[model samples]
Target chain A: MTTELSLVADIGGTNTRLALSAAGVVLHDTVRRFQNEGRQLNDILDEYLAECCPDTKPHSACFALAGPISGDTGRMTNLAWTIHAPEIATRTSANRCILINDLQAQGYALPALAPDQLTPVLSAERDIRAPRLVVGLGTGYNAAFVLPIESGVLVPAAEAGHASLPAHTADGRKVVDWLLANLGQAQVEDALSGTGFAHIHAALHGEKATPPALLARCEDGEAKALKTLEVAIELLGGVVGDLALIFLPRGGIYLTGGFGQALTPWLRQPHLQTVFHDAFAAKGKISAIMQDFALSVIGDDFAALEGCALRVAQN
Target chain B: MTTELSLVADIGGTNTRLALSAAGVVLHDTVRRFQNEGRQLNDILDEYLAECCPDTKPHSACFALAGPISGDTGRMTNLAWTIHAPEIATRTSANRCILINDLQAQGYALPALAPDQLTPVLSAERDIRAPRLVVGLGTGYNAAFVLPIESGVLVPAAEAGHASLPAHTADGRKVVDWLLANLGQAQVEDALSGTGFAHIHAALHGEKATPPALLARCEDGEAKALKTLEVAIELLGGVVGDLALIFLPRGGIYLTGGFGQALTPWLRQPHLQTVFHDAFAAKGKISAIMQDFALSVIGDDFAALEGCALRVAQN
Candidate 1:
């Protein structure tokens, strides 16, 4: 007798990862990555199924997309792809299909991730029943609030990166003014994303540099590069702190995405760590309560796929 | 045979309003108000019970407090009263009791409010199935996000008032700088609450004036007073817009509390209304999406009591 498999995929800007799971456990060996290039998502999925399981019709399918999902449809942020649940179900010959935001997928995977896959930024007692928050910092920024319900968890989508950056100190205001003048709008994503790092560097030094080049300069103890990192870290801390108050994520905050992972090492440095904690905990009377929230980084690349599998299983 | 009634109360700083409900409907005739006058919450509850339901034991009880709630315990923000749910349950002879923030109560009361009770600030399409937000601007500032679940609506507590103020324009930053210099922190409450009105008045004109006094001056065509009102409304709009992005409350954004009510007339003024809307929809790329959120003022005085009754009935 053959076991019924469920198909899950994570669709990003340049790559798409496809995997199969039985009962909710991902078949790690069956996972494969394919370049999006300029082909449609349906074509990629057809190729993936043909190569992996030609004769087997999956029981269910779920796709986690790096963009907004409205009803049963989703549009990719970086690529020219529009995903419809009904189309995917028809293409995969699956019983049911669903689409969710990538950040939400990260939120659902939080409960299933092992300790070795997460690195703690701040250690605190976590209330298992409380809500968790997943913050994504990549080509673009967004967040998802993971609410634990009796049946399962509910991950609500948020467009926080498009909101105005929170400015406290005079220096912060100066950066905000610079962003307003240069970018025409001072949004959180303008200063906290991968390209945001470059913007901050440009704002301070009036020179263009990629995030990698700036990171290398910081490693060499360059004062300007170090200041850029400090500004970005402090801004991130302030934004995350504001989010914590809004969401009350006592289950802890998990940072994900390429930019977030890249900043993990810099976030661990003694001086930058202090800057982050201070900005995060500087909410006047509620500063003490803010300290109760633990922070961590999700290092698993397949977490979103796992999240998609878990979502399919829950159905 | 005596009918089993549910005891519900809205405990504010200066006054405590108590009422009895039956079958999820609040008995309007049983509603009574008593001045706290340095009295404990238990004492007020005892007197209310003695006067309203002398010969009967309540089946359940719920209190809506003007403060934070941790588990079943709550402390009044502007009054020295601590409420413990177990104590209230025992005193009222109720099977169980729950404590929730007043903003949360407003959130719960949204569905129960009549059309006449809500005056629209910004008329737009509302998705009833989507989340709603209640923002309180009275003695203190806070918000509650009302998520529609299968069982009932879940109103999550938020301390968004303590978050840093979002400033975009140079003039707004100047006001923020003033708040940072004089108030030691530039929080949302520093420029959006009842006292914050006076702070803005003082910041612009370097004069001490009450919120009411400022309003009267604005009516009398005082430029500084009008400017103060403009600043407050713009700040409120910017903050609410940021919140809309974060919560994605497509259901609606409800403004409650005394200060919010006072600002309703001012928000209706043509020029000030323009100021408010412009500041609110100023979010760059996602500015158009902000227009979809319907803004309204909750004018019901007994909404919190009704919310308490609803909570008891849900139990």
Candidate 2:
């Protein structure tokens, strides 16, 4: 049997990973790291192709660029790349070049992920036919929701990160107000992202506090660091509850992205579920029917890459 | 063409509207406005059918209820009515029966509504191809979101009203705290529904303010009443914004229900724009993309009735 190779690129803020595969099955796939901080996208692309697939005419390429991919011309928030699909297709000499939201790429990996990839955090054993929400907590918070339909699969792009964070406590309200005073807007992403952790830790542990340092201290079981993480996870779980109420993800909730990875280890802490169920327990409305839903974290790997491959298979 | 007549019901808290239609045209439709508050669903159905449909041996009937139609059993929050298709079929002697969400019934009306039936509030307008959001604000706040797919439509039940409201102001923060103290939970519906209005009015104008008087004063534009409505619209807009950001409504935001009818008059208020815009603007993530969306009131009369007719026509 003969196999054809296609190109796949997972475009991130700091690095650009390009690989070659056949029908989404990676074969001789490789990457070429670039300093997108300084160079042009074309320069990076030329270097990647030369190193990975020289003298080979690939069928097509799928570009999963970070930031918002609203239309044909997608611009990166952190990097200097303003990507155009048609333009990239011509430049790469490929048959097609499609762009999807990075979170959507993550959504594609929802089913591809195995039990080993996902560690059960707050298990609800949700209904299989129910819609599952894919929340990404990275440099920013975003969500991509998927529902099983009579048709096949449905993925809706979600900007839930900007949706207001529920302020249940006085301290929660204080964090909201403080973040608003500093950033002009109080949002879940502003309070739950890595930068959000730094902001909260800095407020508690002075200006020198950072997300990495806080995580390290929390690893050491530092009380103050643990407190900060508890509050962050509490807020994060609260938002997940809010999202679940809004979407009613019968398929269960899957958390992803870099921040999701960081928060994974801390999910089992008792205080997290306390805040989660507290917020989720809405009364006098659809609260009673809010059963059969639980939160879980997606297995860490190249979910985005797997998602991109999934999209190729789907399209 | 000789046509067959079927049973159709718009089951609500207070009354049930039953109609007999042939070839998707109503032959006889009347409201059997029975108080569902005191009676069992079976008793109400028995009483409702005896008066409404005397002589109809139809094939299939679709009952649009105001609750999650996850499976055979359906439960409504505002009333004591739980319906099952098989149960209704056995009693009514029907071939097939469906109990779908009321908002979903309204969603089926999306493709049928005329341009004149909509009163456009926002300016730019929506893409129409993207999934449209259908929101209901009547006896209580609830929502039913429908996703458009290539094969057909995917209507997902969302207790979106129970989603937490994000408070931005000191006044709002105080309100959030008060809700937590008094109501034990601070979900959005706790502040934005019909009951929520009563709570907001009480919170704003002491414990003595009544819904009838407050609504009347609001209608008369009395200062306090107007202020209450202002907060109501702002809170309403905030939730609308939340929904907009969640789905990025490409088909536009269709606000329905009696509450929507009340809000129709105040659609262009400055507070409405501020609260709604703040929900999207805070992200600075999908802000530009959001500008393309517009808000509108679904003004079609008896939309649920018309929706029932549509089901007959298409099915």
Candidate 3:
């Protein structure tokens, strides 16, 4: 069961974060963030294991990937990393290994999240029993809804952000078309992610810039950068509004990751609220009831990891 | 629980569908459909019991309602009838009395649905374990998603159709606004229900008319009703598209009732697909994966009643 020690790792494109813990709940001695540019994850894991636990072999390994999980292997969406479970388990000699879509793993952690952990963005009576909608606005945009089941004792999560971000307005249409023409990436994530900043920047000002540059410019009150983020945030709100209507997560709608912190402050912002509220208002009373649920962003970097442990705990 | 026969009735505005099932599964002998336009439901039940099972004093009763269910009593959204649960339970001497939003009951039935019972509108390898989304386009529009919890389930039902029906285009905006002003009902359900026909008819002809009359005209290939249904259907598609993005129902999306049937045969029809698909396609891969979940209109008229029975069985 790996009760003594379990390996919990979150592998993104540029940085691979690994920590050894007891059931992925409480961190033990091994927490390290390393760049994956030079070595494969197994080589990294092997080096870490021999250095950290020379005599003992862990029984269970749970991983969260920053990409879509196909079978037992997942290729990192943003990095040149290809991960397969069997190879890693065979090499690591771990008894059990499972890889879950990061968003799903994040969702699994919703139940265990301390109430204090959530900074309420929308203050409704946080009914712990209602379905909770969890979304991640991270390196790449994605979302998951953790819905209460069986009389509110359990919650199942899902990837919801990839669901289209159709432009419902002239401005939205402009943004979408701009992304298509400039970014040339296929989906909403292309425009919703950090990379989306470059596309948005180029669309608004006729030249591309990285997310950091865009954020820096916006912080410095650059007109073009602020305009780009303004539109992007509105679009994000509209999509979140659409999801709230679809899931009716009475428990609440949660925005996770650093991106959420960067964006959620714009929660009550007029442009974003208009798009968010109007999207559901088109559905009728569900819009009215949306006021019944809380909206917030979970500001934890290790949410997915915590969720991975939480998911395993369920099993 | 009572071993004696209990009634599980599904009441709509027109016909009352009743099932005298032991648990939640329907028993052939207990299926009863009674026309209730001229009489009260209590009267109808009394008569049915007299003719069908005079000696049986039922134990408890549950009903699936087509209108919003908040308080104890109920009134049919499209009919002039009152259903007081406690009053009925007391009179009928049924030991238990309960009412559920029809869509919530439908959500419960998804895990138990047979393949043959569902006709695929779109083919997707559904994650059966994932949360399943259920939508009903009946007299009033609503939706619910059944979230699979640790071992139990949560049925978060929503009156989704009324939330907001944001117009996606100039044409959509014009049609929706015109219908709203002319129909004197701006709510999504007002312009998008059976009543929506009259609104569409008025929009097409610049005057209001009855739905039945409009349908009759359309039956003879009248362009007015056909055109109106097209606009209404387009709006309906847009609403569904919004839902597709909101829930990310990768498990599968089930559409129930006559309106869904009328639309299903038309998902492939011209502008309809664009109106619906574009809404979901707004995001990209989520749109691609959504195609994996088959969209279907349940063929069985008895689905909700069967679903109610299935709900009892699960318990």
Candidate No. with top lDDT: 1
What TM-scores result for chain A when each predicted structure is judged separately against the true chain A?
0.97, 0.90, 0.86
- Listed in order, each prediction's TM-score against the native is 0.97, 0.90, 0.81
The DockQ scores of all candidates, in the order shown, are 0.78, 0.61, 0.31
Model 1: which docking level applies?
Answer: medium
For each candidate, the alpha-carbon lDDT, in order, equals 0.89, 0.73, 0.67
Q: Label model 3 with its docking quality class.
A: acceptable
Q: Give the C-alpha lDDT of model 2.
A: 0.73
- Name the regions of candidate 3 deviating beyond 4 angstroms: A1-4, A150-159, A166-192, A195-210, A217-233, A268-287, B1-6, B34-60, B70-98, B111-119, B123-131, B146-154, B163-251, B264-291
Among all candidates shown, the one with the greatest TM-score: 1
Model 1 / residue B146 / CA error / Å:
0.8
Candidate 3 C-alpha lDDT tens digits along A32-72: 77789978898889888887768987666778888877668
Q: Per-residue alpha-carbon lDDT of model 1 for B1-315, expressed as tens digits?
A: 865699999999889999999867899999999899967777888898898888888899889999888888998888887889999999889999988889988988887899999988998899999998899999778888888888778887778898888888666777787888897888898888999898887777789999988889988999889988998999899999998888889999999999999999989889988999999899997898898899999999999999888777765
By DockQ thresholds, what CAPRI class is model 2?
A: medium
Give candidate 2's error at residue A155 in angstroms: 1.2
* Tens-digit per-residue lDDT, A1-315, candidate 1: 866799999999999999998877789999999999968888898899999988788999989999988889998988888899999999999988989999989988988899999988877889999988999999989989899876688877778888889878656766787898898999999988999999888887788999999989989999999999999999999999999998888999999999999999989988899999999999987798997799999999999999998888776
Worst 10 residues of 1 chain A by lDDT: A168-177
Proportion of true inter-chain contacts also present in candidate 3: 0.32
DockQ (model 3, Cα): 0.31
